[model samples]
Target: MATITKRSEDYSKWYQELVIKAGLAEPSEVRGCMIIKPYGFAIWEKIQAYLDRRFKETGHQNAYFPIFIPKSFFSKEAEHVEGFAKEAAVVTHYRLKNSPDGKGVIVDPEAKLEEEYIVRPTSETIIWNTYRNWIQSYRDLPILINQWANVVRWEMRTRLFLRTSEFLWQEGHTAHETADEALAEARQMLEVYREFAENLLAVPVIAGSKSPSERFAGAIETFTIEGLMQDGKALQMGTSHFLGQNFAKAFDVKFLNRDGKQEYVWATSWGVSTRLIGALIMTHSDDNGLVLPPKIAPLQVVIVPIYKKTEQLEQITEYVQPIIKGLRAKGITVKFDNDNNKTPGWKFNEYELKGVPVRIAVGPRDMKGRSVEIARRDTLEKKTYPVDNVAEIVDNLLVQIQNDIFQRALDYRQKHTYYVDSWEEFKQRIEEGGFVLAHWDGTDETEARIKELTKATIRVLPVEEIKEQGKDLLTGKLSERRVVFARAY
Candidate 1:
């Protein structure tokens, strides 16, 4: 029943409308927060299940950490504190009491604590502090732990899932005996994120390292998966950081070696958040509505029955039972919409808008011919199929739809990406909006200046490492390789 604004007319408005009209999420009363509806949570659950399995497969264990961190804990690391200080939300008092003027509640003066607590913008400080107590010997060398939690940052401007003050995410913090092991762990997780983004979410990404200016605070190196959206803006899908000995030294986390020598532990941290939902929407969705890949869609197949009489409806259900059972046996999610309140025409549009990968409609004519009407959301194409082997047909169709959508996104990214060598060309290409590969002098000052001039920052330095003779776009100095530059979300 809901219609979305045309994406060609206004991309930002189209996205916001699709998110709400599809029943995914809505703006909450609390500023910079969102209330994820059941449909959206289901999609998130699928994402969690897949990623959690991947984490455990790679030798990571789930763990919990405190939400409230002691304010002084941040001062242990200067860069970490500086990175999040502006956005950190602090709790100054513990209790609330009735206002003396009798309007509402106020902070209880008598219940104030001596120390303030910072709502964790990240768990590194507290987690490392706890690690100091947990690791004391070489036998406890590698600690690979992950936590799924909600974090808050007081963002001045926010969008539903893209830049919320509070959002759900999973962060992996690992400790190793040597710097090599820590670096390898970080790279391994980056691969995990890359595969997850391309195969599961069906969103193609560029796997690379962040520039020094864009690196995670307190990290020696940061690896990231960046995806280009339909609007030509790049979105960082996930990041893995090689933390070196920074946190270990700050929190005094040391383990005794086999030779009885004390040394600081090496560390790594990585995370991906609900911002991925926004990426998914922007990558494959269209003017019709949200277009979901079968691998992660909450509802893969929806069957709508068409009938005029009660007996006709009963006949359709009887025929669909085996097909539904067969589909379910194959681990396919299907919903049978027999609700008489809504007509079949209305149901068809509803599932299309919701981005159900496949839709099947069973009616009297199809029943006479032992066939059904089938529609594929990705292609927006419809066909008639014999009901004899509907389950197998639908199964194969789901797989095809998933791969098709991924290829579509990959093609879009390829079309938008550009390689430019001249300053004038770089400026024009950037304004056109897409990923630009250009030479840089590998200096933070040049990086900062380019962003100031064009508002485009380095998105990543490719893992494959581009080696070529070139000149910087702005300074015209000799450069070793070209880096990816784009305006990002």
Candidate 2:
């Protein structure tokens, strides 16, 4: 197996190596695209399963929108088009035919399209256009729907899950009768993402509203959850946007209100993408390999038998049968590896590199003693437990590991987070890394100037903020409260 680079030596290289070595993902033939390996995709499956159940619990239904959107539909929403114009991938040709020069197949001049279609960078426009046909009255006002799909954004630079040209995500677009209803839906979905990020992914995040300049295109408000990675950089985990009537007005989607007046539907959109996989790795994985939270880990437990001869291996396997059955009864995923080709030591290192939350080793001596040795990936702590209660003990240990992993990350964030009041301190702190909470003049020019000087944009404005009077670090202008500033992934 290839060795992973130490994070201290090169955090970026370490990340790339870990992603590959851990069997997560690899670059594809296409530029700025990646192929998510089975192991990596399994992690994403867990994320989707949990969030999907949560979304349905809140009255959202799964629906799919077209991948190809009409070109004219984009021109309807000015801000939305401006935001994604550069990344948009347009399909101008419909078919390919044999070239006259005999160089392989090429786009046939006769196959040119009437009006180009864009590979969707986002579904707000196309979804709203469809909503116009379905919505005609207050009864159809709130269309609560979510779609699991892949999107393309022609990126110049990309990192596997972090910023790939093509990526998987679930987007929720809803239409409501009133602004308050749409705002509530947006806030509700943000809370859903917050809980999913913190509880299931075991990733600690700060919930806040994006600054006006940082809000999603055509959105009146954008709420986000940002996580602090081990390298002291921030990753945007997810976002929920209150789009108001921007898309509705752009698409000419109107409905009959209770007062018998024609009004545009209120709008909101939110999504969480595969970049979350990157956040999970950067937040918790170590130099050894990935350290997956128990809840999100694909294979939670792996059993490796330690033995000398084939006879002993058979004996260990026979004894482990009941144990495996017991664990499975409790709904825990486990694997028993008794292959003779690989040595016990190799198996130990392999499972550690794969980040199995727990490993149980059995041998002749342990069988005789009615016990087995167990090691947890989170802390690398091992203990000998009686075979009879091993299943119950492991179930408890998994819970403890999950909570402890989250706590460790939470502590790291608290330690690395800095509060600065002066420009010098701001510059110094920003250079060092982590979230820099500092006062800003809250002007577009001031925000732009700070990015030029420090390369740190406002990550989020704390939803629950502490009201304080201060001056902007850069301008000495009056300010109210502090916002999080970070150079993000």
For each candidate in turn, the TM-score is: 0.99, 0.99
Clashing residue pairs in candidate 1 (N, C-alpha, C atoms within 3 angstroms): none
Worst 10 residues of 2 by lDDT: 458-467
Cα lDDT, all candidates: 0.94, 0.93
- Clashing residue pairs in all predictions, respectively, total 0, 0
lDDT per residue as tens, model 1, 124-215: 99999999999999899799999999999999999878999999999999999999999999999999999999999999999999999999
Q: Give the C-alpha miss distance for residue 221 in model 2, angstroms.
A: 0.6
1-489: candidate 2 lDDT, tens digit per residue:
667889999999999988988899999898999999999999999999999999999999999889999999999999999999999999999889998899899998898999999999999999999999999999886899999999999998999899999999999999999999999999999999999999999999999899889999899999999999998889999999999889999999999999999999999999999999999999998888889999999999999998888889889989999889989999999999988899888888888888899999998889999999999998889999999988899999999999999999999999989988989998888888999999988898999999999899899898889469989998899999999999888
Give the Å error, residue 15, model 1.
Answer: 0.8
